[model samples]
Target: MTMTKIAFFDAHSYDRDSFEMWNKDFGFDIHYYKERLSMNSIELTKGKEIVCVFVNDEISAQVIDALVKNGVKLVALRCAGFNNVDLPEAKGKLRVVRVPAYSPHAVAEYAVTLMLSLNRKVYRSTQRTREGNFRLSGLLGFDMYGKTAGIVGMGRIAKVLVNILKGFGMNILAYDKFPDMKWAKENGVKMVDLPELYANSDVISLHCPLTHETLHMIDKDAIDMMKPGVMIINTGRGKLIRTEDLIQGLRSHKVGSAGLDVYEEEAKFFYEDHSDRMINDDHLALLLMMPNVIVTSHQAFFTREALQNIATTTLQNCKDFLDGKELVNEVMAK
Candidate 1:
């Protein structure tokens, strides 16, 4: 029997470490690539049966076609979101699988981390203290207790966040197309409409997946609906909030603070460091310059536990496929 070969793209040191450790159980031949999977890198998949990709990889229709041509049978996504993958094109050509629920607590806790860090001006204070300028002049933060937190999306991560916010004594207002009424009632979370959530929440955190209807959901109109000086935190996809509109909102004092783990154009710059080079993306640069905004490089799901789960689940997905068993995490076209 031939050993299974996998071409893993957008692989960092952490990814290589986790996958290599986990591959001991499966004994698959894995080739890790530092560069993202793109048209130029399609040649790497020539002899591989599977191509494992991270969030930043370019998995377009053309790339999918090339993968099929290169004898790639599967495209395994290491991350939850599949917005980057062209599913329609890969319908029959390629089988796609993803690690959908790897350490929800990691993301939920990160969302809360961003919220607290932004609200308390922790980043600003730390910078001042480091420079020997500990002045308590511009650092006034509101109490999380007795505050309203609106959460969009009632997925695993959102539920975890709800529990955390409830512990903080926050009134939770959640909006999900398919609301879990029983769960919400038990957890003391009020299921409300988007408009109601927008109008009432002191802090709004986004956890929804990026879809056609949800793309640019937080634009000028949504910002107008929100409370004055609202704090926005996004641990989900970046396109959920329009970057240009968000910058305008910040400048207009409509959005008091923003904690972003992802950005719309983050693919070009997120995982890799470009501190020495100039940031060509104007919107990203502007957001970074803002005192109230905290931009993270999409590391909300970077916990050790999450990495292990991702590696195990992803390899299991491959094992199941090769064994002709039902793939529990297989992603199919709608």
Candidate 2:
């Protein structure tokens, strides 16, 4: 069967390799575009039924209209975040599908990895050991067992995170709009309201989406409600926690440490190396300067298993849309 061609925009070195390795079984005419996909790149997707996008691509209303005009019917996002996509504009214009929960364990484990690496100062100690310095000073870390973990959002990633922490006997306190009471009971997790979760937890991790209601949810008021010296981890959307408020928390000793995998303005510089150039974003620079803060380049979902699953799902999403079949991961604009 001759498969429908799919144009993969922002097909970086890593992205192309991962997609090619997993999508060999699927009959897809994959055209790779290493450059970031913008409205200007709409012509490249012409005659293609689908366009697969990455984290860096701009899929706004203008781009959506352009894609439709260029004969693209479906937009498959390999990543989970849909903030960049103008869903309302694309409503009935083009089908939008995403790999919503591809390898939740990958992101969940990365969150824990950040927590442990920062808590024990493992990265610092490893650096010193390489220099033949056997100093244990300033490397103290508290036990995770018996510690209280407050998880915001009880989504797939958050559920896996809670389960991982459960192995260490960590008490889980969760907050969500539609809290999973059954899961909480089964896991011995306490589903509390937001304010209590903030004020009482030893470690607070955000696993929520970025929406108007959730924007800067961890601002000054939320930070003020948090326990002093509490550790904050955000492996989810960056806008959930205000960077300025986080800086204030770090400076005021309200937040002991931060393990961040995403940032609000990260689309500008992330997935690209700029060693020779000076940083243009002051907020990122300020966060980087903090000893108690650690940032990863939105890499919580960068594991091989996750990438393969994402690629397969993305291709399938495109195929489904072209075949006039129901899209399992379709994001319908309300």
- The top-ranked prediction according to TM-score is 1
* Per-model C-alpha RMSD: 0.7, 1.4
CA lDDT of every candidate: 0.95, 0.88
Cα distance off (Å), candidate 1, residue 194: 0.5
Local lDDT at 230 for model 1: 96
Candidate 1 Cα errors over 4 Å, as ranges: none
- Looking at model 2, the pairs that clash are none
Per residue, candidate 1 scores C-alpha lDDT tens digits across 14-53 of 9999999999999999999998999999999999999999
* Candidate of highest lDDT: 1
